[model samples]
Target chain A: MARTAGSDGERTEAAIREAAVDLIARHGYEAVSMRQLAARVGVQAAALYRYFPTKEDLLFTLMREHMEALLGAWSEARPATTDATTRLATFVANHIAFHIERRSQTHISNMELRSLSPERLTFILRLRTSYEKELRAILRDGAEASVFDLDDIGLTAMAVIQMITGVIVWFRPDERLSVEGVTQTYLSMTMRLVGATTNRETQHVHAGTRLRA
Target chain B: MARTAGSDGERTEAAIREAAVDLIARHGYEAVSMRQLAARVGVQAAALYRYFPTKEDLLFTLMREHMEALLGAWSEARPATTDATTRLATFVANHIAFHIERRSQTHISNMELRSLSPERLTFILRLRTSYEKELRAILRDGAEASVFDLDDIGLTAMAVIQMITGVIVWFRPDERLSVEGVTQTYLSMTMRLVGATTNRETQHVHAGTRLRA
Candidate 1:
């Protein structure tokens, strides 16, 4: 397929992607049609196809970008210290903030994997494993250093990921808890979940963070 | 709708529900039509409507029954004692077991809420609230009795539910971890996550369990 050019094309493509996410999030990926998406974006189906030749192509793009954006955000948010507790704290905050802000994208990413091709599925899974590996390394280091008591690194990592991602399900900014409030609550639960042994360790981590700030 | 007579009608209803769950689980609920479902079940569209007046009615039944069955299972599994840790343990074990056994139903119940009508959605949400309240009560009791250390009862309960229900996403029967093995691992994680204060407390809880066994 030939590509569109310049800023106008970029704007249209962005619009299409946004509309696709909202539609697919509301309805499952298999049920959404190109015509419906084009109408949502006020574009012709042909224009939509010009950017994405097939419906799966559009879904694959959305999923891949969601993962890539998450990876980028984590890399930027990850602290330079070797302390696992500090690193894990940052991971929880970043994960919650990112998913909460992109609820539609997160929903589509989590729910629409069934609609992807085998090759694309493998690609997305690899992206997820790499992101998860970052947390696993943090958990491993924490367990080894006795800062965190974890029975199974793999299961703990999965549990942490699912628990945090679940924030998007019921969390609303207009609710009793603000994003910061929710993140704080989750951070405390996560610290306890990993068995951060003492309040002193938590305070130590926070004190260092405050000094840096 | 008029009723179906005999065991043959009973079998067809069973087949329709089974086919509907599998199809809706793969493709979003909106994408699935009564015609497609009937075809998959080797019945006519009219026959499907005979059992389910509207497509939404079918979805509501599946969601309602999933919650009802989960509640019923928990009631059977709920321990008589007030030891929060033991009750919490039972809750985790029962949740994982029920969801893992009904993977398709679980997937549908979790993912298809967007397709339901307003009234049906409220009904399903109430069932969920009631079910979740059971966990919230357990957490509240544990916190009140100082058996479990938790930051927030509601958040902790949500985290535990999301973490355990997530087992169905990647878990397979033929995998290295048997259901019991997964349950034990999760049980350990849950115990730690709630900040179960001392090993002695855990052992005390278990000693009573052992004697009963």
Candidate 2:
């Protein structure tokens, strides 16, 4: 009976965190409160404290989970045979796919990062830095081999992240541009940005879709 | 005499807004308040309200000004040259220059946009859409001219904006990378992203300061 209760409690906590992430993403962190979050989760305000000591703690939990997920996705997609370009392409695609799927969580993590304590924010920054560093190493190798034409790998790495992260800013599920389409579009841009010989060609259209002139 | 007094009042209000932009950029928007803003401008909170009715209004006004400045800069630097490559390259360089100079305003505007109301938020969204539309038009033209390779212009435009906008997330003036260096780096990536063939010939470690691989 106790085991079942603990499992239920954990589930409830997860629900609360998810609700908070959604609202905070839609609204800013400063605009949300425990009462609002509790209402969203269909739980009483007092009951939430049984799982999270404070709103900050709940937000922190969400951020921690998101980071782990990002790190995991990148690591899982990486393969031994993956060259730098392919590795980066996979990384960018997976990231855009994840952001499009869980935009609310991703939005919260990116915008409200400063709300955390200095120590906690530093820890998160390190994870971010480490992630960028790994990509930079690949970029460095590519530049050394003359496979890419990027001037600064650091700047390019940052641009890759920003470009992919922007998916959360305006991407819509109902849009005609499918996830595959967006990913392929970004991949093409990224490859060209890095100076890959993307010689394969596609027919040109003038003033057709907003994507093609 | 009355007109002179009005002009003085306008100057003070502008100063307060500038100080608010500077502070909020260094710190996130949530950490700012009317009281702190007034203090920064050497005025009391009550006096501050003569210009801005509320803290949100002040932020909104600052955001509007910043957006106008961005649009203006883009308009001013737009070369008369019809060549898609030069126009896009100039746009990329001009965009980076704006990002570097007004880093703080852009940072605060994005972070606080969601904290605003539906009416206010819609206006900001319009500002963004128009900006995105500019890139979309340019990319579409470039793709038609075979100077760019992309499946979706909308996605490509977002990638470019996000890549540039992402700089505010980590860029620091105190850092070793100069505004010029950052500009060059972003220019290369953005140029490549847009399928600009002009920048592809530039080699690594070219022009002093080996842009860290």
User: Which of the numbered candidates is closest to the native, going by highest TM-score?
Assistant: 1
Which residue pairs show collisions in model 2? A206-A213, A207-A213, A211-B153
Please state the CAPRI-style docking class of candidate 2: acceptable
Writing each residue's lDDT as its tens digit, candidate 2 over B98-210 gives 77777778777777786677898889888877877877888888888887766677777777888887876788766688765676677667776765665544422232222
Q: Which candidate is the best by DockQ?
A: 1
* Candidate 2 global CA lDDT score: 0.72
Top model number, lDDT: 1
For candidate 2 chain B, the 10 contiguous residues with the lowest summed lDDT are B204-213
Tell me the TM-score of each prediction against the true structure.
0.92, 0.81
DockQ for each numbered candidate: 0.81, 0.47
lDDT of 2 by residue, A51-164 (tens): 888888888888888888888877876646436666556666667776787878877788788679898888888887878887888788778777776767787888888887
- Model 2: runs farther than 4 Å from truth? A1-7, A42-46, A144-146, A198-213, B1-7, B22-46, B54-56, B199-213
